[model samples]
Target: MEAEKKVIIVRFSGELSIKPDAEKYQAIERLCKQISLRLSEKNVFIDITHFHDRFQIKVSEQEVQSVCAVLDRSFGVGNYSLVDFQCSSKEEQILRLVPNYQDQFSGAEFRVRVKRSGQHSYSSMDLEKKAGAILGKTAKVNLSFPQKVLHIEVINEEAFLYSEKRKGPGGLPPHKRERALVLMSGGFDSAVAAWMLMKRGVCVDYLFCNMGGKSTERQTLQIAKVLSDLWNPDPIAKFISLDFTDSIEDIKKHSSLTYRQILLKCKMYEAASNVSKILGCYAIVTGEALGQVSSQSLQNLRAIDLSTRVSVLRPCIGMDKQEIIKKAYEIGTGVLSAKVLELCGITQGKAVRKANPSKTDEYLQSLDQSLIEKAIQERTEILLKDVDGKMLQSEYLFVDEISEGYEVIDCRTQKEFSQWHYAGARNLSLRELLANLKSLNKKKKYVLYCSFGTQTPVAAEIMQQSGFQAYAFKGGIGKLRSLQK
Candidate 1:
């Protein structure tokens, strides 16, 4: 019988597939669960027939690319291919699928490979020779150094054929391993590190210390969300934002500038440790590359690590910046991380490489424990989702209220502001506003505006939290312009 049906053959990574029988079986089960969870989001149904040496997934032909995208994000998949078609166990059936491989092998040197299981009268070599003879009519056949390879799999009474295969994320399925609290900074390093842990099957929850303002909080939360969506589909990863403004102020006042950077990290570890206690996670992850900066020096890192008793996992400790950025791009966080505004004032001066532990302890002892406790007490949790799909519940200022007593702050770049802006609107970007937080007239009410309006509410929330009368301009500048016209 000859019938064309769409199927995918999934191969597990060597690391997971080579485990002991029981462990391998469990890992495969975890992978199957993840596959089903992630694909369900696309409204695509995947039917898994069995799991042994390979997984057989059947889906609609239209969803092949979508399935491949989801499989690329999954950790346990080593490689997968969309079978061109399935046919009965016969040599003539193989010839039917040969026409489909012409475009791929037409102008290139190719080879035919065959694999078989169960009863087969003909040897694998015999099948390969017969197929290669017909396929060579379309292209040159090079048994070695071929540009393309046509693969054939015969199992029981069925046979599958495909020309291309794609590599997967190649790690354990997330949540199959233990969970950890990652000190996510929304930067290249920590994002990549969190991804690394997730690749190894460790479910990662994000802990962000809001060092700048609401912008930083939103950025970090969004970054964590990106990691969460990539790693785990179920058991939504929790993003905890700690208001470190007071703590940042304390460090700036008491600690020397040279040590401010290291002290900030130490405080982060302390806060993370406390958060870990509440979450029941014993491990912490960071993006600290060894000697990447003064704060990441061996001595400074030791001082920072001493703040928490839990195991600190640094997957990128030996990698350089370029490598981490490349991984970030590959995993889909590069563009978002690149857009995150770098808020100034977290580190005011050059950091010291060799920080003494006793001195660090002295600085930690001098800080107000009440403020640290208060920071944790005021922690906010943001559940990550698509912006338009979720109701953020942020307060807003309607168009009619703009002319009242509110001072309008155009949060767009100078280039955009120079083109056209609201009358008497003062241009202050998110970056400039954060850097000049102390200089703002907090006595006056303020309305923040952005290009698309998606970002203003976050800025407004930060201002409100800092005791300022602030609200996001409803629908942002786009709506405001339409109202004026």
Candidate 2:
């Protein structure tokens, strides 16, 4: 009464040369075991252990195909293959059936295609010869146009003969590495940039520079945390706090304020390089929109980065603000930290009249000792969490910008809010937001949210115009769930 079960065999290639750690192999084995467990095939089996039995560690012809499929797109893997495919035995094979009818097949000539397992006994040429001889004796041999050609395969102790062949996963797999530093600010562009990199499996490490000088505001930290929560619920990616306050001041003192905006970035890049070296990272990442701001200009990014030797990776380099924000919302970081991200205006207010080398140096020198020490201390002993509430994505939680107080309100969906919203939050769907708006006291600065942040902006705008200082959640509820998960 039960249906037949199907199986996919596997093998490893170049695995010996790579010499992956036991954990890696174990991970792969576990993935395989999980697959086997999920399927109800009685014949499902895998035997990578055979690699130890081979003289050259070569995969059998039967195992090469399936191994490749499973290994495809698997990062940190050297090579793999779908090796052995167990099928009906030679006696039960269809090729043998064709030979019996060779006499009846007169017009069309068919050739048996033999792909003997490399380690198995028979050879393709030999099988082909044997099949031809058998068919020749049975009927007029039309080897060139054989109408009943069959496929035959043998590996280990099993043999498969059929009229059709199972194809393998063709083409190279996508290559991805799970580590990159993303320059995250409480802005949509950078947030989206980081999200895109994360999607590519690049384990994101956030370098939040207080280039605008509002790092002291707690809002910055909140925004960073929201973004952090969305990408890594339990927080896998490290958020590295970078103090550009002093550097920005230094640039302003040494150069023209107009240029301060650009050179300030150079110093920030220099600082990022130092931080990256400390964190065992190299690439400097950001969410710079091409031509969006003076500092984002190719000339400016190149000018500023000239201070460092490390390569800069702008994942959202060519993207527009709307595109970046769209991605940020999709990734669930857009509105969670809405309140925190709004502090950027204050940081920008700190940029000076002149930001040249000498003045820049002075400002750097003048940085409050307490602030510098505190910032470093916080970053050194930071804790990171991912969306799943696991304490993994990162061990580092850079200082999110410091901020004053305002009641934090989350407007994300109930499910999202329950996963992780502020300790005190009101569940208000976007549809019911208008009715709830009437209930909110005008005196309170209303910050709104959606599940991952979709409706807060509209609500905030409406409330702000109605004489309330309304702020939206930057990273939204999705980010909160990521903390310590």
Candidate 3:
């Protein structure tokens, strides 16, 4: 007459099981804490007990589905199942429960799988045979390949019976390893790189060097938040943003034309290293893949490494671009990353394929190191969980085309606008637009365009913050002109 007991069994990854006793204990404790946090958000409470290689969560039957979702996305969880639990492993008690699953065995071939731990009166094979015989009344037995698998677990004085097993993310628990800083660009590669490191038990924070102003910073932070809220269980994930526009400009002005791309990477590395040191991160993680870009070439990467004191870790170094993209989609960052435009086009001419370390260092020295240092010093840090939709509202401040009744504003200089501008587009330089903001009609929908589509996003974001409906034309004037044709 006792109520049927339902529990969720979670098997920890093999990696965690192989750790030293003390490390294993700590890892399990952290994993449990993480699970509790994730479940608490959904109003599901659980009583957890750890076994040798797995853990059991006692929850109501109604909460099993929600808990299963948490386990599926959580790192360090190998697999999980919802099972009926009995306090006693007595053969008669298990036999009584066997008939309850007859409906599952009907019209299918099934085999019983028994796994035993601790001192048990019956062997696993004996239990499997007994259970299969009971299930065989309604189903045919197929040892090699069964359409249905009824699993049983015996430990000491308890028994668990289940018919379904779900796979988990299957990696070491997060925060067990040293912390690292991911140089996130709000792109597919960097976001996936962070997830890969987290899967390996590394606690990762993000460092965003903002080259495209506030809009880029906001978008990047949004992407980092997605990774943290979904994959990372640790509450200490921090996102640091530094405006690198000045440092990039410095490189453009003084650095060699051919070495601009490499030099810019070196500057980013230097900033990341400094920030990593301050934050106590052991390494700087990047999304660089060999030959994926001009600056990511092997020689350029090596030369760029010379600029930073901290070690660099590229999780995506050997991964194909398509492979990385697929993973990005799997980890829930692909859609967000796809919206982020590439803003690091510093290379004006053909960049050096194999950069010379000495020359790269010399060019790096010619620029103002103070700019990089100053940006690092003035960087803003936010816990990933604190990021909200208001911060990411700028993502809506972009339009790909000019539609009917939409007023287009060209944010170029007078001479540039006079030479060639969109038909019926009002010419309002960035400075003039800002100066006349109060006089413009608030009810009209406005679209702004600059030379390369980078600057107008900032303007559009500012306008959005001021309660105006505005958007920046994507791809700048070039794409807009193409669309016109």
List TM-score per model, in order: 0.78, 0.45, 0.78
Where does the lowest 10-residue lDDT sum fall in candidate 2?
393-402
Pairs that collide in candidate 1 are: none
* Residue runs of model 3 more than 4 Å from their true location after superposition: 1-5, 84-87, 394-485
Candidate 3 structure quality by residue, lDDT tens digits, 1-485: 74554788899888888999999999899889989988896678889999988999988775666576678678999888888546478877887888888997897998899888888677889988888888898899999999999888888888888888878898888774579999999999999889999998899989998888887787788778767766774677899998988988888898778999888888888888888888889999999998898888878888999888888999999998999988986776665677688687788779898999999988887899689878977888998666644455546878887899999898865645765678999998765676689999999999998655555666687788788899988765557767888
Model 1 — which ten-residue stretch has the worst lDDT? 386-395
Residues 15-45, candidate 1: write the lDDT tens digits: 9888899888888888888888777755677
Q: Relative to the true structure, how large is the alpha-carbon lDDT of every model?
A: 0.78, 0.49, 0.82
TM-score of 2: 0.45
Least accurate stretch of 10 residues (summed lDDT) in model 3?
A: 386-395
Query: What is the clash count for each candidate, in the order shown?
Result: 0, 81, 0
**Can you give the lDDT of residue 221 in candidate 2?**
45
Please rank every candidate by TM-score, starting with the best: 3, 1, 2
lDDT string for model 2 (252-364, tens) is 45554455565546555666676767666658787777787655665556556656798888888887777776666555555433434432222243444333445444544
167 Cα displacement, candidate 2 (Å) = 26
